[model samples]
Target: SQQGEEDPQALSIQEGENATMNCSYKTSINNLQWYRQNSGRGLVHLILIRSNEREKHSGRLRVTLDTSKKSSSLLITASRAADTASYFCARAPQGGSEKLVFGKGTKLTVNP
Candidate 1:
């Protein structure tokens, strides 16, 4: 089964705000990657933090991981309308194949 499943399937935030989402996985994972896709568009790789890493940051994005809990969180700070997109968290199992198994996703709306 796909390891990661993001909760709260959707979120709405005003522009210039912050949005946070959580993901939970069932099995051991080698890595977790977060991606974003605009409506009707291809997904863009946002960030990837390996199993050994606890937290990572890129631009306005902050991601945190907890292997013990098999969970992760993504925080987008000072969000903009351009940040409106669906976010997905995918996992590469520790001893499994390389292809990513993606979550259904969290649809984020940034209201201008």
Candidate 2:
């Protein structure tokens, strides 16, 4: 499958703490993206990292990609209760279809 597998199916943390999630895939990809989804809501794009990039950051989010290992990781710094959501990793194939394959996701809960 082109979809990635996310680590830690569930995570719970206190507010203001950092949260980290990992994703591993089997095949090569063009790019990998992270998305957030609140309960009963559509996903919101968080960040994307190209195959050539080793790391990238936006706001409180940090993403790292390792093509050699076909893996990636997302880090949310100083998380808040509002950050509680399911985070998914999606990948675009190197070629062919433009469709993206997504993982089940990691459920994060931040307690105040």
Candidate 3:
């Protein structure tokens, strides 16, 4: 079964606003990562937080992980219209699966 799934499947905001999304998972994970997809093709890696880490940030992105709760959240600050895209949370398997289970994703629309 898939290990990760995101909540609030859709989001909309103005160019200058921030966007936040949440994710829930079913099992233990080695690490959790966030990716952004433009249109419907390639996925661009954003940030990653290990199971032992509480929070991490990169540029305008912030990620938080609560391993005890098997959950994570991604926050995009100072959003822009170019940031509009589909964002997904993926979990790295605990074992040596060498595969990632991705969430259904949250569609974010930043209107200019």
List the lowest-lDDT window of 10 residues for candidate 1.
Answer: 1-10
Question: Residues 36-76, candidate 1, lDDT per residue (tens digit)?
Answer: 99999999999998999999999999999999999999999
lDDT of 2 by residue, 17-38 (tens): 9999999999889999999999
Per-residue CA lDDT of model 3 for 1-112, tens digit only, reads 5758898899999988989999999888999999999996899999889989999999999999999999999999999999999999999979877899999999999999
Each model's lDDT: 0.93, 0.95, 0.93
Query: Which of 1 and 2 is ahead in lDDT?
Result: 2
* Stretches of model 2 off by over 4 angstroms after superposition: none
Q: Which residue ranges in model 3 land beyond 4 Å of their true spot?
A: none
Task: Provide backbone clash counts, one per model.
Answer: 0, 0, 0
Q: Pick the candidate with the highest lDDT.
A: 2
Winner on lDDT between 2 and 3 is 2
TM-score of 1: 0.96
Please give the lDDT score at residue 85 for candidate 2: 98
- The lDDT, on a scale of 0 to 1, for candidate 3 is 0.93
Local distance difference test, candidate 2: 0.95
lDDT accuracy of residue 92 in candidate 2: 91
